[model samples]
Target: MNPIKLNLTGSPREIGIQHGRALYEQIRSQISIYESMFQYTSKISWSDVRDIAKEFKSPLQSLVPHIYSEMEGIAEGAELDIFDIVALNCRSEIALGRFSDGCTALSWKKSNNARVLSQNWDWTATVKNNLAMVSIEQIGKPTIYMVTEAGIVGKIGFNSAGVGTCLNAIRAKPMISSKLPIHVALRLCLESTSVGSAVKTLESLGGVASAQHILVSDSTQSLGLELSPVGNKYLTEDASGLIAHSNHFIENHYVEEPPWLSGSPIRLDRIRYLAHELIANGVSGDTITPGLLRERIFSDTYNAPQAICCKEDESRHISTRSSSLFNIVMNLNSEAPSAEVVFGRVGSGEEGPVLKMPWV
Candidate 1:
């Protein structure tokens, strides 16, 4: 694969906006909206909205006119305002589209998350400035093209202050399209300075969204948070150390699909096998490391739930569609109490130092 490598280092808010500008442009050419978007979805608590707005800072806001314009264009279909658009930029709100796309986050041990396997996936540019990376998959939607917001981040790479977030694909239609999409909300989680802040940002938002995600961070914590705008519910699974997540829901009352799922039972087993292998082999923050996540995510052979290759048998009329491996990984290998996002891709070259986030 002709993988793209990226290295960007600067202030936190600017880094966030810089990453997103391209996505705004791409969405513009693809989906033409007729009105302005919201700064926050209607159901989101006012408090959460306020905190995220603070994070955007003035400099970040300066670069948002393009996004605001896009919001105006898609407003007829989504019904959002420019303020909601700004809030989405700050990671305060999330847009849950039709069809349940999801995300999951879990913490493996620092020792386990630290491991680094040699990456041959050709992602040299991605490691730098990527303090975080994301794998984007659209099970039944066209809106989720590349993972970064063109780099804006509705969804983003894990590894922020020891917290990692991942999104999933599902099926569901919204009563009202979000002012902010799910990917943007998760990206906001990465921009948080602390795990507590990340948790607060993720759970408080309200909207209809499909999919599952496992958030892992600081090598000691992990969480599986689920959001369903249809059910108007959000749930989280906690762990003291190691954790795993699949495509379906693991909750009781809101169980629609299992987070531990995929296109087939075999796919489910495949992820389990890999998860077990990594953890058993001491996949700690000091061992397994973030680079491995990229390698595994793009692997044509063992990436599990293969992209869309034809199976070996004739009766298998299976559609080998690509799910979540559509985006990049953000490996946040921090060097101090303050985060210095050492970004890189999972499948890229040997993990190396790239951008040192100016926020540090």
Candidate 2:
């Protein structure tokens, strides 16, 4: 174990400020790089950004500038042009915003009937900016957040509440007035009191405008909820039993993939194989360990593709703005959900808590 580093028990507001400071003091340069990149990568309007930001409880929005600066430094170090930066950001949003239709959910009860074992995942992108390796040991626990310039963004974490939330993204048509940035909405959902509330947060409050989400909450009872938001359309599949997910849309009509980026399809294929392999290898619902979870996401397939690469068309490449450090996982028990931040190697070198805010 990493000896349970970082303090996780705090209100959403407190963690949001911590995220701001982490970015300002540790990753300001990288955040700046991303700010410029986001202009083109994200189709959202400045009005939308401001509007979505308005939903935040003042303290979180105050850190946006600080986070932007940190991203800029990462861009400068990598020599990314404006388009390259935007494309990279867009690619990452696709990775973080979308949800896999295959994931299963768990429902909590008043019994210790189920337990978490471990988590292992191996993440790879077409660019160095998105390369990562991580593993989690032990059962479902809490993953806390740290204040980066971007407020309290929960990169990864498990909770005593038996909830495990991972974020990914996919592309869609340009969002106008109705579309909201996913990060803002996710922050709100993370702060929510329960999964039901989290779903409401995304729907009633800070709408993703255009995005996909995979929410996994295990209350000792398996229940998986996959939410997809693209424009005015909303779709979800409740497979709250035994299942897994990857980077692909589920519904046929609503499978809104932009085709601007590639590789996720292949990743999904690998996910299928890995899921079966784990199950066959004696991994069960309650016994899934963090180390196993990491492998499921990041393990290298003998003939599978590598994550980072320098491409001729920079738009196709991933960057730190896309991903620099793979945030480690935090396990959660039966408690209120909080942000379990996984620090990236490139950004802050260590993660601040990713707060689960209360908008959902």
Candidate 3:
């Protein structure tokens, strides 16, 4: 399906209302699917989900009023209750064990002055049909473009400020509370004008419900942050100017090993090796175009269900029936930051036409 393009502006609530109404049916369908997934995976009922969603309201409104306003707008526009929308926003936290896997890489060359940030969003195959590309123009913020599931405010994308972000789910023992959830934090990151601001925005959230690896990049710099409910740490690129992360934590002494990180270690090593190999072969800067990156790296399906381009594995309890839902590559150095989204998985040999999103 063609991605829905939404140009939203005005007050926070107004922007959200426009977003919700424009994709109301898609939002409804997403909610239904998430509800079933929750029931089947965690045995959590709709009533419990609503109650849990309400728990984040006070913190969200007090800390990030704009995001709250957007959620309210989504509720009103989609004709669903405010708590229902909140449930969708916090689904990652609510359904902790069922999170997806991902791979992110950043590379640049001083000689040729080319740079790129790329990621493959691995998730439930069903989400492939529900994805949408949302372009948001809001007051007091840079224009943002994101590829997200309906009813979700953020995932992977870049902003007009030449800042881009990619996410990888991580697991840590004894989850705790924080001022904001990861999805909301993702929106905050995209709203940032620079890499420093993006890092500060995430650091400001003293605690988080779950763990995540937020890979952020700007025209000149790239950072990989490991955030958990307890604390956060970060890693920068080595001499090769290559930084990559999968679903597991790589920072030193962050937390106990996440038991749910199935195939994470292998995938992490594989992606890191591939990225370095490309760097050694002079695939950096403009030389590392999106198609070349896809063809050389993401198209590798060596490990079947656990490869860089993941295939479905029904037997796995965590990512049961999950595959690469989308692939995105961003040119952070461009005058108008832009991204290319491949709607389906890259390695499956069925990737859809590339959708170019030039900054507005």
Candidate 4:
């Protein structure tokens, strides 16, 4: 089935109330899923997770109160505790590099000047039922069309302003609750008018809670921001105007210990190879489009189970098995900014229906 679709507008609180009322059951499912994931991955109970979530309350309210208000709305709308919503927003931070979610993301500026950003979001298949496609309309912020988990405020998607974002989770250390959470950072990017403005917002805030790599693209350009609590780094597109990142840190980072997720390097190399090959072909004559990328690059399963379009392995333990939950491709052209979200593994026969963005 396609993920639940929601169009939310009004004040932050009202929006949250609508979201909460509309997806109350899904939100509850999301909370239950995370409660188990936290215990299995981080060896922490849900109560402890809530306690960890409490640390970010003040920072969120002080730094980005609108989002905090929106989150509060979600909690109130769902008739759940605010901290429950906070825990969902802060899951990346609370997990502390213990969870396993492997994703491969890319941003390509085609010779035709079409800016494209996409990724295969890999995670445990259990959360699939709770996923959602959210379109948010607010007074000041750009209109947002994104694929997000039930309770989290921000995630992968593009805005009407022609700004788009893709996320690759990085599991590096020295998490600081005072900084913005990774998912919230993606929300801020969606709210931005330009890639430069998004970068400025993240930089000014002193980076995110933990480590994450966010690929930001607009009508003009695409760049990757590798954020960590200690410091942040910028990765510009190559001369070919292509930037690809997997779970691991691509550039030298703030710490000596590199983040580890099995098969990350292999998946990175595989996708890069396929992308360059497609670019070469495109240079000769083949036009590159979101459909082409989905079929060629993301559909690849060169190394079963651990491939770019990941699949769960029966041999692996239930807690460790991960698959590509969805694939999203955005064409960020000022003339017509659009997105295509596929709810399951791209080429995996059982992939879900395709959902196009901007509603109309």
Candidate 5:
């Protein structure tokens, strides 16, 4: 299925208005799915979810009012309360790692010097149709093209400034409502001109609301930020210029993280092994392209349901069954940043048609 493509410009509010109005149906759909997800995963009612979400409003208004303004516009345009939009954005923190949404992210440099950032977003299939590719144009900020949940303000995508980001939800946290949510932090990274600038901005604010690993990259470099409310750690690339992260924390962060999903370690090893193969083959420049990355690394099925290209396990409950919802590979070239997205699991014949980014 073709995801709804939205192009938004103007101030944060105006851009948000376009987002809410265009994807109103999708936004509502997201709300319903999250309501079920929260009830099943966190055992929290939807009403309580919104009440908890309100705590973020004051923090957002004080720290990053622009993003709050965009949420306001979305509420007005979608005819819902601003807190509902906030709830969707903070779903990760509110869920408190009860829900395990697996993903594998990687960053590597091509022979021609383009930095490639890619990942497979694995999650429950119930809300797959609610995903949208949103492109934003704001004054002073870089143009953003992100694939996000209908009501979410920020997520995985690249920007005009050659900065791209991918998210891997780390199921370890003491959810702090006063800090910046992971989605909001992602928006900040996309708005940054380079990875260094993005890292500085996030570090200056302490850290994010929950534990998350955001792989930020540009034409020249890539850095993995393992952010939690308490502190943050940076995971650098290897000597070969490669970084791979799954759901678990690979660094020594003194955090209480038990591997909730057994697949996290298996997938990480599989991806790293595949990435090293590229170097062994003497692949560089033109040889190291997005297509090659998808075909080689992200498509592995080493551990079945827990592999890089995940598939739903029929034995699991409906609420918990998961699969790779979509696979996106971004080529962060300073001159021309672009991405290719494939809906559904990669290499699975059930996957949707390939779509290119910066459409138009």
Candidate 6:
């Protein structure tokens, strides 16, 4: 399916208004899905969603005014309350209160000295049709090209400054918080001009509301940041110049695991094994192109629904009836900064059409 594209510019509110108006229907659809999921999974009423969202309003406004403006614009355009938009942006934190097991991200330096980042966003099938690709151009910030659900401002993507990022949902004991949400943190990372700046941006947040793993890289370096409500830690590349993260923490001492992540350990082990095997079998950076990365590694259905490229299975205990929303592979070393996004899962021996961004 073709994803909606929103090319927005100007002040944060203006940009957000344009985004919300242009994708108003999609945003509405997303809200509906979230509402249903919250009801079914957490028994959370919309009233409570709004109330929880309100608690963060002051903090969000103080920490990121531009994002607040953008969210305000979204609310205005979508004809929804500002708190609704805030709730959507904080979906990770709220939803994690009930369920948490989705998303996978990896970053590695190519043998040719280039850097690449890849991720598979696995989520409830409800918003499958509500996804969009957004390009945000701000006056003094790095241009952001991200793939996100409607209404929510940020999820995954890279920037024009050669900095790229991918996100994975992680769980911590007592998951909810009142600090910066993961989605907002993601936008902050995309706004960063470099890897260091991105790390610093996250570090500056002091704390966040939920646990998340951010796989970030630039032309020069790659790192994985595990963020929690209490503290954060950095996970650097291993001796093989590769780092992969799933729904659970590999840096065990850094955080505690939520109970619903039984499949996380398997997924993490599979990715690490595959990555190392690829390198050991002579799949060097020169051979690890975007297509290969998607088809060979991310698409592996070794364990069915729990594989790197997940599929929905109703029988599984930890399944969310989720499928791959999209697989994004970015070449951070590209002169103009580019990415390849394949909507939906990459089936066995089936190569789907890959959409290249910033059309050459």
TM-score ranking, high to low: 5, 4, 6, 3, 2, 1
* Candidate 3 TM-score, true structure as reference: 0.94
Q: Over the stretch 1-360, how does candidate 6's per-residue lDDT look in tens digits? A: 778878989999999899889988998887787787778778888779888888889888888888998999999988889988998998778776465447777887884447888989888767878988889999999889989888887778898987888988876754545578988888988999888998888777666788788888888789898878766778888888888888876664545665676677788888888888888888877687888888678888887777788877777433256777789988887466789998888765443478887653
lDDT of 5 by residue, 215-268 (tens): 999998898998888877898878888999999988837577876999899899
Which predicted model would earn the best TM-score?
5
- Over 1-360, each residue of candidate 4 has an lDDT whose tens digit, in order, gives 757889999998898888888889999998888888887877889999999999999999999999999999999989999999999999988987777888899988864546889999998898899888899999988999999988889999999889999998887788899999999999999999999999999888777899888999997789889888887788998877788998888774694446477688998889889988976775422266768888999989988788899989888667767899999999887777898889888877888777799766
Off by over 4 Å in 2: 1-19, 39-155, 158-160, 174-180, 220-242, 285-287, 295-297, 302-324, 327-332, 335-360
- State every prediction's TM-score relative to the real structure: 0.51, 0.56, 0.94, 0.97, 0.98, 0.94
Residue pairs that clash (backbone atoms under 3 angstroms), model 5: 111-284, 111-285, 112-285
CA lDDT, candidate 3, residue 248: 79
The number of the candidate with the highest lDDT is 5
- Evaluated against the true structure, the overall lDDT of model 6 is 0.81
Clashes of each: 106, 127, 3, 0, 3, 0
The predicted structure with the larger lDDT, 3 or 5, is: 5
Please, what are the lDDT tens digits per residue for candidate 1 over residues 1-360? 322323333433333343344234433321221011222224445344544454433423343333334333333223333344444443312332222222222234454333111111111121222323323222221111123433334543444344445554443333223333455455545555445666665555543233434343433334545555444333332232444443444452443442322433344345445656676776655454444653443332343323211112223221211223233333333443212122222233433453332222
Error of 6 at 10 (Å): 1.0
lDDT of 2 by residue, 215-248 (tens): 4444443333334444333233223223334444
Question: For candidate 3, lDDT tens digit of each residue in 1-360?
Answer: 577777778888998898789889988888777877888888888779889888888888888888899989988998989998898988877877465555544444333223477888888776666777888888779988888888888778998888888888875554554457888888888999877898887677665677777888888788787877777888887788777888878873566654675677777778778877877786655687888878888877867677788878878654256777778888886476777888777856677888898633
TM-score of 2: 0.56
Which residue segments of model 4 deviate by more than 4 Å? 111-113, 283-286
Candidate 3, residue 60: the lDDT equals 87
- The alpha-carbon lDDT assigned to residue 27 of candidate 4 equals 90
Name the better of 3 and 6 by lDDT. 6
Ten residues in a row with the worst lDDT in model 6?
316-325
| Residues forming the 10-long window of minimal summed lDDT in candidate 4 | 279-288
